[model samples]
Target: MKNLKLAAAIAAAVSCGPALAQTEIVWWHAHGGQLGETVNSIAEQFNASQSEIVLTPVFKGGYEDTLTATIAAFRAGEQPNIVQVFDAGAATIIGAQGAVIPAEDLMTQAGVEFDANNYISGVRYFYADSEGKMVGMPFNSSTPILYYNIAALEKAGVEPPKTWEEFESIAPAIVDAGYIPLAQSHSPWIWTENFHSRHNLPFASNNNGFDGSDGTKILVNNDAIKMHFSKVKEWLDKGWYAYYGAGWGDNQTPFENSEVAMWLGSSGSFGGLLNSVDFEFSATYLPYWEAITSEPTQTFIGGAALFALTGHSDEENKATAEFFKFLSSTDVQKFWHKETGYVPITTAAYEAAKAEGYYDEKPQAEIGIKQLSLPSGDNSKGYRMGFYVQIRDVMNREYGRIFAGETDVESAFNVIEEEGNKLLDRFSKTN
Candidate 1:
């Protein structure tokens, strides 16, 4: 009887061998709703492709919340194997010594081939360290662009503007046609930081914190930015532009409902707008201040990347690298790009889409890629400022006062520089 029982136990163990050997890698991310569903689908596909690794994705609120939670968990020695961090937090994570395994190191240590050059330079620059090593896996990258309601433009008898001057000139007509001429999210990323990059204007010293955080100071209150905001203040005073307060989504409704003719939004907004909006629309490069420069330079990318946290075992790191490899595959990149409207992270993925006539069918998707592919200068490489989340908050507060007419544009910008420098100083001291 004992021999028979041992034989049955052996058989049962043999049948469940693969299941027992599978490694589970927990990934905490900020994607929710439809995006959350897509993340799960990717994980499912990866799991199905291999019996040795299983990805468990957990939604942990928005980007800021996810970052905060990850930090707290790390201090408690209970962090997930992977976490998605937004561009704003890239510098913070990169400066976090011993908190993360740089993506390049992680892949190499796990025997997975990773070439930093495989990523789009514009997208990769944000997550790379001083040695050009990628600190995180580029996942969803996007640039700011102008989205206009097609029907609204027709009704207003005006075409989309190419320059800030043209936009101001056409604003009255758009307003006369019973639609708000312009609306933009109060997020400083769109209005200030990216605005600076698009025009090749420096937002800070030390090469925008790329060289080092030491001695880095805010340079945003210069003449170029001042001139830009002055125009914005004029538009606000004339009721040509609508301010919908701060953050990402507050300004989207007016554009979606067609009450606003044009809005500045992330390139990723394309996918969501396609599914939700009732009206036809098109996107173009964001308007530049032609007076500031002869033409606009490349825009900086804004999106999150996956970072592998420390304290995970070698097996978990191997699993994480495998998942990252799957993510960078052309097929998966194309799917993610199509589903999220994020720019494809690699040239191969972009070429795949181009070869399939995907761009012809969805031209809006190509605008961001074109903008990011444009000639880049020092200022356009990307911001690597520390504590940028807090810097953005300061920009929001001061810029709000300017929009509300509580303070002049110059005064608000000055306050931004002063307050921003204080924050930078704090970061420098700590880091």
Candidate 2:
């Protein structure tokens, strides 16, 4: 058995005449709680499987903190060999000249077997460069999907709506029936970024920054965007919608507690909801604009990937790349998909799991594959916008004002578009 072989490998190395010198590779990650345990377990198993390498995965708080620490370490010449970064930080990492070793390049340099085509379309595209080459290892990627309360929809005498127009038509009745129609997490993600993209609208002037991040103008001040905010503000006014305030946990709590009948959240949240909620639920495609009714389009991947940090020794770099290959192996992909709610990155792993009736048991998971595999478009391939964090802050705070009735929808959007553009402009000049 592989387990027995791995144990023997460890034991033999420990008791050998000339003790094997292990090549140490450190990984900085963003996961905590049960996710931390998964990382730790994987590292242990990998260490046991080989005598020459010891992969050490260290949790470094949340996504932003992990990125900050990694950058700080790089400046101090103490960066980890590998660092997990969220999708929002992709452009930032790529913009860091000579500070990150492209993951694909690292794999080849370390002579690790790798195939870019093995990864899922959505996961790979989000982490890829302009040349359609994967610049980082795709790991734990997710996308936003609609989560509807089955019982609540049934009681309202309607199935889950497929479009935003239909969702609005059914909203009032759900509210009248004493159920919260929708609980949206606070961010420009679902409401603005993912929403505009799913409907096939561009977020910037340069094809959503796929061309490049420089000189990118914010093109979001359009009729569709205005319509979106106007409707959202209206829903907030009528008490039919709720936005998750301040924390990631706030959105799902309302849905789990049955305070809201409809929710839009990260697909990665599915496992948590399944464990916490007593009620029946189903995940479905993100709602599209009625104008996009000709055909459903793709949504963006929402989670993160692992990037190889720069300024490390040749030995450390080689070990990190080896560990990356280990993680990308089909076995580990299946393990990650099964353990966490995150979908498998590899096509092989996905098919293997599907053949075993894994997704059949949970119909909601099918949404992820379908959404991720849809044809690439300006919106679907994923945004590489610079200054994304700053843009998000502007969108979040200004939109929060719109939701809280502190400003009219038009005024708030005007400010968000103007401020976000400035941040983009500033980032372009500097980068």
Candidate 3:
């Protein structure tokens, strides 16, 4: 009787092991806070909808930190199946060559029905090569937008600025009314995107670093860029802008507390603002310079895309593809957009949301869609260059020097261009 009971217990334990051993696929990403919750919820939904594969979402800090961790993992031969890299890291990922499997091929091999045409052109172009092959799958795409506290604006007796000139014109008045006209966090990287997009100027040669490893140029010294910086400096001189220090997390607090009347930040920021702001708020298209011949150009995507890391088994790769398809589904995409305030990557998803009156009910959400839908010239698609994340740091440093009156505008631009080009040259040769 003792021998029989031992055999039965062994059998029961063995049976439970297989049930618990689901095929787990690891996903490393740079999303935290509310965005992180959205990612986990999507993974949970996908897991519930299917039993063949399980996705594990891992939080890997901010963009730069995530990239560093991914590189280290790859070097140590323990990379995740999928990694989310931001736009600034696009060139670096593409330049990594054999380290990554093109997202398009992975999806194709998985036998998933994916139509490349279904994605928005602006969003797709950034992740694709010259031959129109996608290197990564678009995820959590966002464009810059203007977020304003309605009560603050009303108290200051100012409307939302429609043009760059208008924004500058009202800065002094806002200051006089005891409101910060603009609240800037010490992040110069965000300013780079806003400045380049507003002027519709190219940040680098060869399709903003997308064309190839050979094309690289810095446009910091361009007349339009200089003008924009001058305007920022002017605002600073008039005490219309307040520096929020180096912590970006605390940067948005001024706007949330209705201390600042206006803010230029990612459209994804809407979710946080919605939760934190007690006063009425409105979002509008990012303001552009009235002097530019063409105003309101398409803004570049700021968020991350999902890349397939090499070394996954065939079955795992196929599962990843299937998961990508599941994410692209109209219902899932619409749900993500509504929940996270990210722009829907697929046209079908956008149309579905429109049909459901999602945009009508939340009018502020339309600002992102409108910004992306703007006419795209070569200048408007998005930036794709190596060492871009580093270049952004350089920009921040130089801009800070200028704002602190450490250097004149021309001198600052000259130094930034020279230093930036050196990094670009080195990245080009190494990649």
In order, candidate lDDTs are 0.87, 0.82, 0.80
Q: Which 10-residue span in candidate 3 carries the lowest summed lDDT?
A: 5-14
List candidate 3 segments past 4 Å from native: 1-23, 185-190
- Where does model 2 exceed 4 Å of error? 1-10, 15-20, 244-246
Candidate 2 lDDT tens digits, 1-431: 75786678767777864566878888899999999999888888788777788787999999999999988888888988889999889888987768788888998898988888888887887777888778878888788888989999888887798887888889888987779898877467887777766777787777677678778888778788788788877887788788777456887788889889998888888888888999889988888878644665687688888998877788888898888888888789888888887888889988988898988899887677777777656676768878888888888888778877788877887888889888888887876
Tens-digit lDDT track for model 1 on 1-431? 64664465456546768458778899999999999999988887776676677688999999999999999999999999999999889889887788889888999988998888888777878787866788888888999999999988898899999989899889888989999899996458887888888888888898788777898998988988888888888888788988988866779998998888998999999999998899899999988988988868888788899999999899999999999999999999999999899999998999999999999998999999988888887788778888888888888988888888899888998888998899888898987
* Model 3 score (lDDT): 0.80
lDDT tens digits by residue: candidate 3, 394-422:
77777778878988889888988898889
TM-score of each: 0.93, 0.94, 0.90
RMSD of each: 4.9, 2.5, 5.2
Clash tally, candidates in order: 0, 0, 1
**Model 3 residue 372 distance off true place after TM-score fit, in angstroms:** 0.9
Better of 2 and 3 by lDDT: 2
